[model samples]
Target: MDTTYTGDVTPGGAPDVRELPHLRITKLAVDPQMSNNCYLLTCRSTGESVLVDAADDAAALLRLCDAALEGVVTTHQHWDHHRGLAEVVAATGATTYAGAPDADAISEQTGIAVDVRLQHGDRIVVGDQSLEVLAIAGHTPGSVALLYADPDGHAHLFTGDSLFPGGVGNTFGDEQAFATLVHEVETKVFDRLPDDTWFYPGHGNDGRLGDERPHLAEWRERGW
Candidate 1:
């Protein structure tokens, strides 16, 4: 295809469009402050795309997306994650999608109501691609993860803040929240997804499920 961009997006400025030849995914990040990751997955055949987590720097996000943008998906309602939500949506008029409970919460901050209220098992359409919604609540009341399966049987998970490389995300010292997050990661993620499943977290670098699979018990026992 003679694509111009390659490799993973960086966490400094507006990333030069990253094209994943393996899965035909186009992603970019804008880390002006919080280093929140914003991704754009485009259907190579259709030119349509979906933006995930419009965190910070709306202008950079818009530049990466522009007319190809189809919709914006919110993984949770955390303030840092949706800092640029209002500006991005207002500028693009892209439909907003979020978990039912979190949809309203995000709307409160962005002031732009969610257009689609997602639930577990729901399918989010992006051109010819479909991303399955996994409701992994715990990091927040309605935090969810998105799973995209490639043609070759591998999978990519967009785990907002639920599942990270070393742990299951911060519970803010709440034991119950910690337990819930742990339980969901075990059942909904580690148990179901394959070892090769690559996950893109909210804040840092990408991680493979296999690299993190062995630490399930440790994470549970530590309870952080």
Candidate 2:
């Protein structure tokens, strides 16, 4: 298993792949304007794959899937996060999944209904592997992070726009929203996961939980 991947990607460029014992994680940057990140998780044993956040560039996303795509999990209802959702689902016939609170909005925005309304603690199967859904509501009512716990290694978290290297996602000055997001992230992520857990964000480079753990108090104090 290779752990050298940095999860750095550029729009219209090739994806950076990380191969694990039972799964392969491919991160790609799409949508030139938003620079959104898209992750594809392929189960090594079964060859089935699931995509997290079909951000944009349908053709590129399709090419990456290469006929092995099984489902698409939208992290939130944000326009940038699902710009290519409709096209990709149409082309691949992949099942759609999203947080229950954002399902209607996502469907309304993309014209594709969500096949599964995921809630906190919901489990999504990708071949022989599975991902746990963690609802971290703040940036959006249904923003969620996917947790992949590897038996042979540390955990992996895919935090859409909720948690990043420096702080949590933007809340548009809504103090309540920021507080809720911080609380959810603190309890569900920082508190539950180990320090070595690697997290892939929606936009930029990835980070480990241990690297970000010390700043929890600072993040809360600044309230971003």
Best by lDDT: 2
Please, what is the TM-score per model?
0.92, 0.98
Q: Which ten residues in a row have the lowest lDDT in candidate 1?
A: 14-23
Error at 63, model 2, angstroms: 0.6
Residues 46-153, candidate 1, lDDT per residue (tens digit)? 778888899888887887786868899999999988888889888888888999978888998878899999999998888888899999989998898999987755
State the lDDT of candidate 2 residue by residue for 1-224, as single tens digits.
69589888899888999999999999999977889999999999998999999988988888889677999999999999998999999998999999999999999999999999999999999999999999999999999899999999999999999999999999999999999999999999999999999999999899999999999999999989
Model 2 / residue 96 / CA error / Å? 0.2
How many Å off is the CA of 114 in candidate 2?
Answer: 0.5
In model 2, state the lDDT of residue 109: 95
